[model samples]
Target: MNHAATTDMADAPVLDEDPFSDENIANPYPLFERMREMGPAVFVAPHGYYAVTRHAEAGIVASDHTRFTVEGGVGMSDIRKPGAWRTRSPISEIDPPEHTRVRAALQKILSPLVVKTWKDKFAQRAEEIAEQAVARGRIDGVADITEAFVLEVFPAVLGIDVPPERIKLTGELNFNQLGPNNERVARTLRRAAPIMDWYQQVLQRDHMRPGGFAEKIYEAEDAGDFDAGTAPLHVRSFFRAGVDTTIAGIGSTLKLLSEHPEQLALVKANPTLLKSAFEEALRMESPAQVMFRTTTGEVELGGVRLRADTKVGYHMGAANRDPRQWEDPDRYDVTRQTAGVHRAFGVGAHVCIGQMISRLEAESILGALIRRVQRIEPAGEARWRPVNTLRTLDVLPLTLVAG
Candidate 1:
């Protein structure tokens, strides 16, 4: 746990690449390779933070919270500092003891029984949507399938009732704010300005529908499971963390499946591989690409010495593709054992609390499709959405052939 410096700061390689630049954001694999090749950790001069690029080092930083803490916030900026745009999530931003309590309460609310019940509902909806998508033949996978399925079912389970347009706007705003304050962040904030009020109001306890999971969070808060007044923030955290990431993940799964028909065939031959398909997709293109942690003191990461209280960004997309970790990192092989190994959902304590929910949702939709469709082919180019820290599809044109 003690990461007291054993190496000189000069050993750390410094690079000037702008990680959030339009070109880099659009195609980061090249830069990711460069960063990983540089060393386990490299100082990204443009962003003014050290990046943990290699899979092993990223795991070390994530798991050993005593050395690299989340208290400074999970974004590029230290939330403890002045002029920070983000507020600390009562769940994600706190470290053990405090985080432990909140997470336990959340786990109780999202129990296995509750998740299984939701899975049944998700499966029914997925079948309905998959039937329609297969019938359509040609469709924008992002809009018609991924967004349609997740946006409908996820919020319904959360007990939220917000327009899809507003959810997308707010999601973009939240993810953008997690990165450096740039033009993209400014633009998204401006676009989301109109819905800001409603976004806040929707997470309030009164807005929660009866018998939904979100209502359970409020109930837990009332029972002293959480700090008073922390209920809304918990609701907000679930909404922010749950929606966009799942959409990105599911979209990536479909895109990968469509492009790699052979792999899709593997899943079709044995539908059990549906979960593996989603896991591999997430590994190839992680939804939450970069998450930041603060160095608690002078620490040595991948043999590089970092100064105390500095922000260290873990590029999940980069680490997930680290050749050191997997046999063929770039290739999307559905059979790869990537579920616990990949950095897609992260590692250690702060590993996404809702990962099971995401997997279940993905399994439902993908299982439904693989069962009904004979083949999935790319109809056109798959365009990447240029969110600062999120790697998601903007438009995926696909042609689905029925079984």
Candidate 2:
């Protein structure tokens, strides 16, 4: 726990750990514990980046972009370098002033008023989905509930005409591509190969429906609120950033609620705790496990100095479970006041803009299910979908006992 800053930057601990390894990607908490025990910031030798494990240091990495700049790209690889990614997200990949302007434009488009109006729509769909799930009783929580609800409501709100299967495939491809280009990425590329063209074309202005959120983004672009030709990219960002992660979080929520009947009972007794239950699920298994930033200069994190221009990944999955910040961090306690405290939605200005939408979605679906189901019990073992930098459930079997 003693992470005394060394004057010699090279004195930082070097771990040969490959976090993207299939084993670690499947279940990372053990390695995360080891990494946290090592130091707040340790150089990951294999990937040649520093891993920030503790909560405080991770916060610094996420918020103080002055020290850990986003200019090098948010992913582990610096996109500005040769033969890397060609396009940066109009939102995530940029810094202040220009970022400020784009954010304002986006905020105006996705204003509280605009988002609030979708509540009834989300609730109506949520009720139908929940009723169907309860009627079936036995169900794959992933397909029957989580993916089904999110795939239906999220895209409808976004106003894109993507098939559910294609969205799921492309989501797998995107999350895998975020980290190392390992077998997982290769496998996903093969799976998504046929639909790559469809993925690209589906986000275009021509594809946006009149009343959907994507259409409004295009309208904003037309009104000089965004750069020409960036409307599609913004919509693309919304799709990529919003859908899969929410599905992952919601799936985890359902899985956890089923496994922890006590917590479910608490939620059932006090309906308000349903929100906390979802928050706890997100804390336990964050969808986006790690987010990267490049050090602008010699940056000191928890007294460990990081090399300039090197990538530093703030392991949200690890930080959320840090013993220093969270007491008995591994236990899934529904009463835990985790909403603002946990790093699940992220820290600082660049935090998930769609978090309210995510919250709305979770609350709507979970609320409906809670109202109808007396007990949510596991039907079989749950299997995690192993993307390099995402923790999500691929298969969650559940028995929805109706009230």
Q: Estimate each model's TM-score.
A: 0.98, 0.97
- The local distance difference test score of each candidate is 0.90, 0.88
lDDT of 2 by residue, 196-297 (tens): 888889988889888999999999998999999999899988999999999999999998888889999999999999889999999999998988899887
- Candidate 2 has which clashing residue pairs, if any? none
lDDT of 1 by residue, 121-174 (tens): 999999999989999999999998889999999999999898898888888888
Q: Name the TM-score of candidate 1.
A: 0.98
Candidate 1, which segments miss by more than 4 Å at Cα? 1-10
- Candidate of highest lDDT: 1
Model 2: lDDT of residue 207: 91
The alpha-carbon deviation from the true structure for residue 187 of candidate 1, after best TM-score superposition, in angstroms, is: 0.6
| Count of backbone collisions within predicted model 1 | 0
